[model samples]
Target: MAPSKKMTFSRRSFLKSSALASGGMIIGFNLFNACKPEAKLPVDLSALNYNDFNAFIKISEEGKVTIFSPNPEIGQGVKTSMPMIIAEELDVLWEDVYVVQAPLDTKNYTRQVAGGSQSIRFGWEPLRQTGATAKQMLVNAAAARWGVDASECSAKNGVITNVKGDKLGYGDVVLEAAGLEVPEDVTLKDPKDFTIIGQGKGNVDIDKIITGKPLYGLDYKEEGMLYATVLRPPAFGQILESFDDSEARALPGVVDVITIGEKVRAYNDSGKNSWTMPMSGTDKVVVIGKTTWDAMKGKKAIKAVWKTETALESSETHDKVLLDLLEGNKFNTRRQDGNVKHAFANADKVLERVYESPFLPHNCMEPMNFFANVSPEKVRLVGPVQTPEAAAQVVADLLERDLEDVSIDMTRMGGGFGRRLYGDFVYEAAEISNAIQKPIKLVSSREDDMTMGVYRPSSKYKISASIKNGKITGYHLKEASINGNMYGLIPNFFPAGAIENYQVDTANYKSNITTGAWRAPYTNFLASAEQSFFDELAEELGIDRVQMHMNLLDNVKNNPDANIEYSPERLQGVLQLATENSNWGKTEAGVFQGLSVYYCHNTHVAEVADITMEDGVPSVKRVTCAVDCGIVVNPFGAMNQIKGGVLDGIGHAMYADFGFVDGVPKSNNFDSYQMIRMGQTPQVDVYFIESDIDPTGLGEPTLPPIGAAVANAIYAATGNRINKQPLINNLEPKEKVLG
Candidate 1:
């Protein structure tokens, strides 16, 4: 077979071409290239090797196989699990395979994003095919050398074998296979034959992480790099009026005090009707110094004045604005099923409840920081970012450099629920470096990162249902939120298609405080509110809580509505598993249980939380989770994700909330804004349904259900129906409440 035609590399493709050229035996994807699959290829190898392989799999003559992971590692274990899938299909031993994080290259790798729990869900097939292609090429090469039919040869454990028992190692035949043309298509290994995927494996960076080695963004260092810090406006809609930096400049080790102007965001009419990157950082003063401590002291010494813009929106007015809109006559209907008006009027019993959640901050453990070296000819950036492709584009535009002249390297993140998705920190570092004409590292203090936040918008929901003849006949939900509605109240969620009459209406109030995607996005709030309401309905009907959910699942199964997105059998699988594992409806004295199930990002999860009162506060004693994400790629990593998500959900529901006064955030540090401590963490047990289906996302699907489970358990423990978040103060001692 002859090699495929060579092609030139685009600016994006050239980033990874050099790495692929040195690493042998890359996969070819002419089939998916024309159709343009959502997950893209490796950097184009054609420019370096003159052969158009996708460039994901590589083998060296030293008996080593190197696989490139194409997603950002934000503590979700993609840095380990993705390579496990590829190595499984390639028939390589786990010990000999090494994983590498691919750089930002859009031409070869499509949709290099870390949010929505979509890394493995979208890359399963493409990565499997990449490995199988490499295996077939090696088998063919071995057969040709042995002068036998290709069907008589077999590959296993990185070795090629013939019918007569002759064997050749993958490293010995890798060079010969590299000369052959990549096969257009190849059969993937059956699930029963998988040796590396289903088995438990530790994170690739465990040794480095546990041994106090440098692997995160804050640990990154460059030659002749100065530390920089910026003082942003006190609040949103405020601008820099004046500053006295004489004291700051006079401090020892202080280099310069520069003023960064407010950025103007222009609407991009030439393309989609969306907002692009701003011109620069917020209106603030930048303090450049020799060390991080020096920058911190200098920043504190500087004095500045700010003036608020009266015309802009304020958080202080959002609550009243949202409350007014919820009752107003005008609303945009997102989904409507049967006649809700007629069913509500004719129902025997009507149930209505209101739920409110406050805006929350990401509070990533490492704070926000990035290192950049910008020159007139080229720009280089290294940082912890969720979307590297978007960051590269923003850096090029901000520095007035060509796309080909910019390069980005991804680092391990301390934590990024969804905070790193934006390129704000990366752009800030690059701009400061460009202005100073030197390499620099920008670090944000805990207070700085907390105040200048793009938060999870506050939201309110009014959910009502009409029950007639012991069956839910009508369902209506009205949501009002700040910024924009994250979830559009689709009909695919629970009780939407299950009921005969369903309708959803929504309204949005403008906000000056920046807002963006949070973990699990809108499902985090919607699932909690809807599930808690369902528990109330079940209590009113005198039915088992688990049985109530099971009945609704049966409804969706029997009706077969086109609006249903999840399979009824999959939902039932997790629910039944959770019920059996937690021994639902049979709890010991002093222990109350809550059950909830949800499906999102192509994954279904059911969680049961056991709660008890400890010193007048709700204490989560234990939690059991049942997840059905098709197939478990890495059992250890998947379990870790579920545990982490459940813990995060519990913390946010029980203790985390942020408030605003006038236009400034009231909670700026951990003293005011609380986080989950190790003492509060509950014991978690995870179980997975055995299946042969393709893998789905596990990072976020387990999060949404945990909140409802905890909230429902709290209601069971106490007679109060808590509709608002931060349930800390809401729960009082039973003795005090009775008095």
Candidate 2:
């Protein structure tokens, strides 16, 4: 591939710089500083023996290939799969490639985040180019040695050979390859030639994971590091009024207790230039001790009084306000495609429904935790962070140190989902360590993590559609939620551009309860609202649900809108594949089925649920999914993501929800907040669409449609239209009425 103009940092300059930095041994490139000119490495690059190659492919003298994965590995399997992409293009043996997690260096790496399913989508091409560029250098080296044209030579399995029979192993010419000038252009192997991309390669850390090796942040330990737990506000709207830590301090293992303070800002408070980083949460008291258990005990021993503001908001009030907004006709129009008023007036029948989704907590297997060692000279942190670059910035800003002085080492996350994307936990650890002048490990108990952590915002959707002669005439979606609003509701989201008379309106209710991006974010609830409406429309039109969606796709395909976002063909592809794979419409007598399709994160996914309730509770016996993410990078890994996404979505829709009463989270642990158990998890069968298009994001696309699929399946079984979420608690299954 002739280095696309998109690649400003050419491979030639990269290899030359690598050779100059390490005397022609290391093959690495630093795009961090190239992207951010302000953030430069403090070390003298000219004097160092080896420059840091943020994401590099190094060929050791023994022919072993090492590829550094720059993104954080939060169980999305990027740590292993990203390296496979590079190795596939490098034409090396999969067994010979070793993957290493790169450290947090903004000067050496850019976009070291794990959320938004962007890791694979972002790394696909650039990583392949890195490998292709390296392979070309090896081919050139071998060609020179044999005195043959480079075009006449080919490299495979780390061996280079010319048509004349001159051959050389990559190891035999390592020095020569490193010495050779990097080629300006290189060719990437076609997908048909790929040996690793679509293959089922086990995770590189599978051994460490299964053998209970120290990989997660909770497993991290350091000398002189004290364990800490924060006694945050009893509720979101409360703050630490006072605390008496005398009894706790006298405990045997209790080290010290420090208070975490916060400065609250209004929703419109963005004009100020003095703010470095927004406060993570309300102020709190943190107890430090020799061990985690000791810290837990000390926290219990401590007496603290929280200022539970009587006027503080609660979920009850937020829901009431949102319900009022949904009931009212006033709205802030986000987008309007045509004359919805005229279309509704001319319609044959009108149908309207209000759907509500509760706030959700990301119950990662391992609770929030981080280890930090802060001193005047330097600050170091190692933990499970999805956004390492953002975490480093928070540390550097908190310590008043340069970005280069802040070192962040990302550890394998027990689970992130979307909770680890925020650096609030990292900030807490750094602040505690800095204040105590000693290394510290900050941990949040399951209760604290569930109650105090950032949460998925609860949303209310008031959707109305007008039907004319078995076809949708007009559509209007009015969404109300807490915190900041969203923008992609109109032209970007599906069914919006497809419908001619479409209007999307939004409203926000400000609150002290902090909300952040959960997996799939707005799409999670939006899909539930929109897809359920489509099912309802299908029922109104006396047609099959899948066929109704197909008819709309046909309308979108034939009468295309000005700014259509999703591909009708891809959506149709997955829908048809899902039905075919799930044996849709042909199932056991007792089993009820529901189908839903969605497109998000550049991927299209259609899910079908085969459900049969047991004792008034739904049991998902099996889930069949059709995924189109351009190309499957790793078959098993991609399948696992879909499986996990399906299970996660089902778990949340069935029972996982958070409630706030008097500003304190009611569901603080598994007892109140339920997770989908293994016995309840369905057997997942996944199929991917074969295509030549580049790989897209798969981490979250499959999750959006699952809630609706399961809900619709429950409706099919019970004839109960459940408009609210957490169907286990919300849906009233009086009697089984299977159709």
Give the range of the ten consecutive residues with the poorest summed lDDT in model 1.
9-18
Instruction: Write candidate 2's Cα lDDT for 1-739 as tens digits.
Output: 2222223345433434233233334565543333332322222224332224466566776678877678889888998889888888888899999887877756555577888888888777777777887888888888888888899999888888899777788777777877666677777777788888889999999999999999999999997789999887777667677889999999999989888643222211433321223254456788999999999999998898887664567778988998987777767787898889998999999999999989898889999999999888889899998888777765676566898788888899999888888777888888888888899999999998888877888889888999898789899888988774333354466886678899888877777777777898779878987888888889999998888888888878887453777899999999999999899989988899988899998899999999997777778999999999987889888988998999999988888878788778988899877898888889989989988688898889989899899988988888888899888887674564444
Q: In candidate 2, what residue range of length 10 has the lowest lDDT sum?
A: 36-45
The TM-score of predicted model 2 comes to 0.94
What lDDT does candidate 2 reach at residue 556? 84
Query: Compared with the true structure, what per-residue lDDT tens digits does model 1 show for residues 30-135?
Result: 2124223343334334443212333355677666887766678999999899889878888989999888776666444457778889888887876776677678
Query: Scored by CA lDDT, what does every candidate get?
Result: 0.79, 0.80
Q: Superposing every Cα of model 2 onto the true structure, what RMSD results?
A: 3.3
Model 1, which residues run further than 4 Å from truth?
A: 1-55, 262-282, 311-316, 732-739
- The residue-level lDDT of candidate 2 at 412 comes to 94
Error of 2 at 659 (Å): 0.9
The TM-score obtained by model 1 is 0.93
